[model samples]
Target: MIAAVNDETNLVEKERKIDAIRWNQAEELSTFDYFDINALLAYLVKVNIVARWTRLDDKQGREMLHRLMTSLDGKDLINKQ
Candidate 1:
């Protein structure tokens, strides 16, 4: 997984690879603990991963990048959160 992520040249693809690795790890960790708190937490983690990808917007990302680049010349940097 590390090699796959490292081999990915596009930034978005690299991010996707990382997310996939995270999801798989979470799934593996929860595989033997059905109906337990850990399983519930892992389900939440998977849900969050899905939600994150669903909310991804290329236009918003580019706009945020532009804002960040513009702020680099200023005293304070732009904060996304």
Candidate 2:
């Protein structure tokens, strides 16, 4: 499981790098800057999606997911309490 997760993560990283390159190329060709807030938000969304999809059976991934959920729950509890 760890191996599989590692492989998936590596692949995702590669894809991200490729995507970045493509984005840069497109921006260059179109004479546009790729540093806008909307672009950043879109990049973050893409990263999260990739992380979730490539998590596989990784213990670290599970832990991260748990931590994120816990943090959100804590925020909800504080808001409601």
For candidate 1, write residues 1-81 as lDDT tens digits.
698689889997888778778777876897667579977887777666666665796564555445434533434323432
lDDT of 2 by residue, 1-81 (tens): 233344555675655455445444443453332457654554455446436544653664555456445633546546765
Index of the highest-lDDT prediction: 1
Least accurate stretch of 10 residues (summed lDDT) in model 1? 72-81
What local lDDT score does residue 24 receive in model 2, on the 0 to 100 scale?
46
Looking at model 1, residue 73 earns an lDDT score of 48
Clashing pairs in 2: none
**Residue pairs whose backbone atoms clash in candidate 1:** none
Whole-model alpha-carbon lDDT for candidate 1: 0.66
lDDT of 2: 0.49
Worst 10 residues of 2 by lDDT: 24-33
Quote the lDDT for 13 in model 2.
66
